[model samples]
Target chain A: MEILTQIFSLETLSSTLRMATPLAIAAIGGLYSERSGIINIALEGLMLAGAFIAVVVSYFTGIPWLGLLGALVFGGLFAMIHAVVSIKYHADQVVSGVAINMLAAGGTVFMLNIIFNTSGTSESVNALPYWGPFKPTVYIGLLVVFIAHYVLFKTPFGLRVRSVGEHPHAADSVGIDVEKIRYICVGISGILAGLAGAHLSLGVLDSFREGMTAGRGFIALAAMIFGKWTPFGALGASLLFGFSQAVQIRLQGLGIPTEFVQMIPYIFTIIALAGVIGKSTPPTAIGEPFEKGKR
Target chain B: MGVDKIDIKELAIELLIPLLAIIFSFIIGAIIVYTFGYDPIETYAALLQGAFGNLNRFADTLLAATPLIFTGLAVAFAFRCGLFNIGGEGQLLVGGLAAAWVGTFDGLSVVVHVPLAVLAAAIAGAIWIAIPAVLKAFLGVHEVITTIMMNYIAYAMVAYLSLKVLANPGEIKTPPIEASAYLWRFSNILDIRSYMNLGFILALLVLLFIYYLLWKTTIGYEIRAVGINPDAAEYGGISAPKNIILAMLISGALAGLGGAERTLGLYHYYIQGFSPGYGFTGIAVALLGRNHPFGILLAGILFGALSNGRTFMNMAAGVPIDLVNIIQAIIIFFVAADLIFRQFIPNKSEGGVA
Candidate 1:
């Protein structure tokens, strides 16, 4: 009885929202790219890059907002490497995504060595201001979810994005620029994933550490799939993951091993993929390179 | 003679692409170093000296390369079956734990104990990937995501077992295995005081075995057929689902052998965080090697050299070791986007009419 009360407390709810914010934003970001037929396993890399950029910018400028902006721009720019390789060169999308991840993991630490002369961590910087009990990015994350749903479903641009992902040939025959739409969608994913990173470093923590994003980008990817690649679905999935993490934290002192708690979200993701909650399918042509004349 | 010449030329082009990608990645790495106010030549010279300066360093390189050879084979084998296995790390960890547990068994001879521990590791690795394999085969879930999720689960589970269940008092590692389970190190057999073990030779034999298996066996034929075109293979009576599961099991077994080598050959026990991304780096190794056994051997040695020498590069050249990772990433990028090479060597098939 006491455990149930502790698990359902207001503190857990607030922590859930805080943790879910980054995941929700990143899932929506991944949704944009995957819906446009580009597989983005690089969300983890983009978020890490964004976190490092946000920390460096905020450290230099003493402004958290500017750090957020820098992260967004850098995220989009970094994602273009993936876009050009997979889109223009017709490289295998998964291979390209893996390269992006390795680059970010290496590049961020390399830059840190040059800038801070330290390898493990950077100096503390100004963090994003809080609004009431939560940071502003938390609220912004909620807003982005609804806006993404409207833009992805209710708008013609969204229709084109969906059309390009589902059947690129049909969309191409109808005069839609398949490559262009894919590029924009991938870029948008980068921007949103960058926001997710900024939320981690600036909104949640104040300093940048090596490999600090851990596997949240991956969890966001799982959330995106678990949500069936829809914005609201992603939001709900993120909440479930966040709630598990919150409860995991709460159970740390209750004699339940922390590692067991940590396994919950990943286990849930595997179970979800196993068709326990119905079939979760991706966009039809998600990982294929777009060719104009090829059958 | 004309046919032989054509085959030779095609083989040359295939080999040339990876070589050029490596060279280009180094040039980019040099540029990045120069831009950051470091002397690229000095840094690379230091890196080379550190990697091959003496017999000891060379042995160290081979020692590091051993597990990579196994993990690289793991990834490459899965690629042959048209699967992306991002679960090598987890499989390796599980295998290590299994070997560690088996090594704890007392009163066994050297031959029986060693093979028993190794077999246990391989089986554990296969079992670890079984869930993802079954899901991918039956339900059509992409192995990429499923395997990655399995990796996280493995991390947590291993940490728990090592930290809470099997850990020695006040240490984050399991108890050392019995002497019977130890893989004979070169220090004991040869004059060199290095940790290089029989695992290096074992990896070489495994490489040859994989080559023979892939090129000579009917099972390998079916696996490759499925990888190239699953629908066609299925139409021809090949069981795609069966091959998918078999390929994953083999891949996982290879990864497990890597973990077993680390435990039985090097550490003699399972330690928390024993791997420094050997599994993840295997992806880079597989791609850069063109997913071939011999190619993987060379790529594994190169990566092993880089990893072995990075600390010296850091201390002697005043260059961060992370630069090696940057170069590795650039290598994978170039390898994946080989179309960039079209400018240097024009495509022969471009202008021919079908």
Candidate 2:
């Protein structure tokens, strides 16, 4: 009973929510891009860029919100690069994504070493002002999730986006701007992912670390799939993953083997992904770049 | 198409694109280095010297290329079969662990023990990818998403086992393999004290085997057919699902063998960071090689040289190792955009894709 009590404690609940927040935000970002027929594997890299830029700007400006804004702008810009290479230039989506990841990883490390004279980490910067013991930003994330869901499912623009993902050629024949929709969707993905990164640096840790986003973007991708690409479903999946991570941390505190505990979330993710694999379907045109002339 | 006629013009055009891409990327790298107050020419010269300056350094380059050849081949094999096996890292980890397990156990003769360990690693790798294969084949799931997810799972599992269950009682690594199972290293003659070993030969054999398997067999034909057009393959009576699973299994086995080589030959024990992103780098290598076996071999060696030389470049010319990474990224970007350059250059054959 005591063990159960500890497991179900308020601290555990809050920590779980906190851990899930970044993943939830990133998953929502993934949902937008993927639903619109673009596979945004670069979310991880984008988030890292956001986190780094947020810290750098915040460090210089001494305002956390500005840091957040900076991240959002840069993240969007990075996504634009993806849009140009994939949507305009007709580059392979997967390869373009890989390029972005490599660029982000190498670029951030390079910038860190050159500008900050550090490796794998940056100096602690002034964090965004916390709203309370529980930050108001968490609520903002939830609100954005709901808003994004509403926009994706209920709006006319959402329908067009969905159509483009299902069959761009058909969508084009029907007079929908396939390229435009993809550009917007990808751009939105960047903004949301950037916010997630900003939250990591300014809200969670108040500093940037190299590879801090680690595989969280991939985890969010998994959550998006496990959630079947629906916004609410993605949230549920993110919470589940977050809960696993929270449990791992708690178990670590109890002197349980930390390594085994660390494996729990990843193991659960793999199992869940495998189980959901054949059953769930991604958007039809997920990886295929939209070529204007091709049938 | 006349096989006898050599179209020099077409060949030159084809060469133009890759050449321009390389030149463009180099220019970008030079600018970045110049921004840092470093001379690009001197830095690159130093890089060359460090990578191939001496026989010892050249050996080191080959050593680094050894496992990469396997991993790159593994990735390219899957690509040819129309599956994306991003789980190479995970497969490698499991395979490494299996080989380590077999190696630490004493009793068997060298001939039997070594082969057994290698087979176990291959089996372990095959099993690792089997789940995703089943998902993709039966449920219509994409391998890209599933394989990526599995990579994390594999990493975590390895970390868990290495830190607790499989870890040596007093160390963070597993027990070293028995002498009988150990791979023969040629460091004694090289006098360089580097870890390069006979695994390079094994890597070469695997590459040749992959070339034969992919191009010389009926199964290879079916796999390639499925990759080009799965529906056509299915219509022609080739089971797409079976082929998918088989390809993944083969790819995983190769990756597993790569891992085993690293453990039994070089490291002598399993440890964290054993790979250092070899799995991801393999993706770049496979792409640069254009998914051809011979191309993969050349690309693998080039990457190995760059990686080995980066350290030397850092020490000799004070050029940051990050520059090499930038160059690598550029190479991948250009290769991925190879078609873009194709428009400019008509067709000229380069040595190989890499």
Candidate 3:
């Protein structure tokens, strides 16, 4: 009972929320892109770019919101590389994403040396002010979730995005531009991933570190998958993973093995994907390039 | 049979595309280098010298290429069957752990112990992938998600086992295997002062085996048939589900063998994070090689040289090692979307951006 209370404390819940914020933000962004029929595996790269850019900008300007703006521009521009190659050039979606990740991991560190004259990490920078128990970005992330749910399900734009994902040819027959919708959704994904990255560097912890996202973007992908590509589903799934991460952190002082503790969320992910939850189908037209006048 | 006519034009184009991608990437790299106030020529020259200047350096390059050859073949084999295998890292861990665990056993003959350990490693890797394969073939679940998740799980599991069950008293790593379980080193026969080992030969034999299996056999035909059109292959009485599992098993085995080579031939123990993303690099190698066995071999050697020479480039030119990374990524991006450049080249034979 004592252990359960300690595990279920308000502080732990808050930390869980804090951890889930970035994941939820990133996953919701992915939900848009994936639901719009383009795979957004470059979220990891975008988030890393956001984190790096946020730090550098905030370090210079001393204002967190301005840093957030930098993340959006840089992240959006970085994601356009994937967008152009995948949507415009008809490159393999998976390969484009993998390339983005490799680029982000390497490019961020390379920039670290060029700009900061340091490798592996950046110096301490001015951090975002927290409001009460949470950072402002945390609240913004949750707000975005609600807004995304509305935009994805309640609006005509949402219906078009859904229709585009379900059947691009059918959508095209109805006069919707599939490529334009994909480009916009992917761009939005970059923006949200940027926000998520900024929260990591400015909100959760001060300064920047190489590969600071640390598979959170991948975890966000898993959350997106686990949530069945729905915004609310993404929220619930993120919390579940967030809870496991919370537990892992809590278990550090115990005699239990750290590796086993860390395995909780990943093992849970595999089980959920395999069949603990019902089968989650992807968008029908997802991962296929939009070609005009083709069958 | 008459000697096949060497179409030098076709050959030139085949080689020229990748060469152009490399040169383009280097140009971009040079811009980045110049921005950082470093000379690109000096950096590249240092890289070449470090990778191939001496016999010892060449041996190091081969030693580095050994594991890449295994993982590259792993990815290429699966690609031939139209499967996306992002789980090589996980498969490698299971195989390495199995090999390490088996190698702990003493009082065995060299032949018996070594083969036993390697076989265990292969089987372990196959079993690890069997889960994703079953899920993919039967449940229609994409292997990408399952395999990526499994990679994290495998990392955690290995870390746990290595610390709790397999660790030597003071070390963070597993106990070293018996000398009998060690692979025969090439340096022994060559009398070279390098770490080159029999793993290189093993990688070559596996490469040949994959080539034969994918081309000469009925199974290969069926796998390729399914890859081209699953519905048609099914209509022709091929079991798509079975081939999926079979291909994943073979791919997993190859990746696992890579792990075993690193453990038994190089480290002689299972160390944490032993791979250094060889499994991920396999994807780039396989794609750049166009999924052919010989192509994968050449791509693997090229990447091996890049990795082996990055340190010299860093030390001599005062450039960061991440330049290799940027170049690698640019290469993949260009290869994946070569139509970006193919448009400029007047190739009447090619279609626009398919």
Candidate 4:
């Protein structure tokens, strides 16, 4: 009973919201790419790049908002490389994503060495301001989720994205410009994933550390899958994972193995994919390149 | 005879593309180095010197390449069956734990104990991948997501077991394995002071075994047939699901052997975060090698050199070690999308990207 109260306390709930913001935002980012028929496992890299960029910009300019803007712009440009490789060159999407991740992992540290002469971390920067109990990025995260839900399900652009994912040839027959839609969708994912990264560096903490995202980008991918690729579903899934993380943090001193607690979200993701929560299918042509005039 | 000529020509192209990719990546890496105000020639010279300046340094390079050969082969073996096995890291970790556990057994002969520990590692790795393989084969779940998820689970499980259940008092690592389980180091035969072990030989043997198995066996034929076209292979009476499971099991075992090599041969105990993304580096190796057995061997060696020599580059040339990783990523990009090379080739024959 005591544990139950501790788990559901106001502080824990607020922590849950804070923890879920990045996952929800990143999941929405993944939803955009996967829904447009591109398998983007590069969210981790994009988020890392964003976190690094946010810290660097904030450290230089002394404005957290401007840092967030820098992250978004750079993240999109970084993702465009994946876009060009996978879409134009017809590379395997997963392999391309792996390369993108490696680039970010190496590039960030390389830049850190050059810019700060430190290999492990950056200088602390001004963090994003909080409004009420939560940071503004948290509110922006929620707003992005609702907007993603509307834009993905209710708009003509959403219809075209969905069609391109389902059957690019059919969408191409109708002059929907399948390749262009995929490029834009992948770009949008990069932007949102960048926002998630900024939230981590500028919202949750004040500086970027080496590999600090620590597979949260991957957790977001799991959330995107667990949510069945819907924005609202992703939000719900993120909250569940966030709740687990919150509970884990609160339970740290109570002799519970923290490693097992950490395993909860990932193990749940595997179980979710194994169909315990009903069948979750990806976009029909999710990993395939949009080849024009081909069967 | 004509078919043989065509086969040789095809093999030449297969080899040429990867070679081209490596060269292009180096050129790009050089440009990046120059842009960063470093001397690219000096940086690369230092890298080569550090990797092979002496017998001792060359041995260190081989020691670094040892586990990579296993992981590269693991990835390549699964790619042959049209399955992407990205769970190598998880499998490797569990394998290390299993080896650590088995190596603690009391009073066995060196030969018996060593083989037993290695077998345990391989079996543990195979078991680690079983869930992902089953999910992928039977439920239509993509192995990429499942395997990656399993990696996190493995990380947690290994950390819990090593730190909580197996660690010696007040230390972050498991108890050292019995001396009987240790893989003999080359220092026994050579004057080198490095930790290079019989594991390098083991890696070469496994490489040869994989080559023979994939090209000379009925199992390899079916695996390749399925990889080429599962639907067509199914129509031709091969069981796609069964082959998928078998291939993944073997792949996992290979990755597990990599872990065993590190534990019994190098560390003699399961250490936390022992690997610096060797499993992930295996992906780059497999791609840069074009998924061929011999090619994987060379690619693994190249990456191993980069990893081993980066320290010298950092110390001598004032270049960051992370540049190796950037070059590695660029290599993968060029290799995966060979169309980037098509721009440079005049009147290239048309085919899908390999």
Tell me, by DockQ, which candidate is best. 4
Instruction: Please write out the lDDT profile of model 3 over residues B1-354, one tens digit for every residue.
Output: 111246765567667767777789889989989888999899999989888878888888888888888888888888877888888888898899899989889999998998899988889888888988998888777787788777888888888888778996667889989998898887787756767788888899989988898888999888877777778889999999999889989989998998888888888999987887788788888878878789888988988888888889999998888988888899888888877766666655555332
For model 2, the superposed segments whose C-alpha errors exceed 4 Å read A252-278, B1-20, B345-354
| Candidate 2 structure quality by residue, lDDT tens digits, A6-105 | 8889888888788788888888988889889988888898899899999999988998889999999999898898887777666767777777777788
Kindly state the fnat score of candidate 1. Answer: 0.78
Q: What tens-digit string does per-residue lDDT give for candidate 4 at B1-354? A: 221145655667678889888898999999999999999999999999999989999999999998898999999999999999888889999998999999999899998999999999999999988999899889989999999998999999999999989997688999999999999999999999889998899999999999888888989888888888889889999999999999999999999999999999999999999999888999988988888888889999999999999999999999989999999999999898887766555544476433
Winning candidate number (TM-score):
4
List the lowest-lDDT window of 10 residues for candidate 3 chain B.
B1-10
Query: Model 2's chain B TM-score?
Result: 0.91
Better of 1 and 3 by TM-score: 1
Q: In model 2, state the lDDT of residue A113.
A: 77
* Ten contiguous residues with the weakest lDDT in model 4 chain A: A249-258
Span of ten consecutive residues with least summed lDDT in model 1 chain B: B1-10
Q: Candidate 4 chain A vs. true chain A: TM-score? A: 0.98
Candidate lDDT values, in order:
0.91, 0.82, 0.86, 0.91
TM-score of each: 0.97, 0.93, 0.95, 0.98
Question: DockQ for the candidate 3 complex?
Answer: 0.74
* iRMSD, per candidate, in listed order: 1.0, 2.2, 1.4, 0.7
Q: In candidate 1, which residue ranges exceed 4 Å CA deviation?
A: A253-255, B1-6, B350-354
lDDT (Cα, tens digit) per residue for candidate 1, span A119-158 = 8989999999989999999999999999999999999999
- Which pairs of residues collide in model 3? none
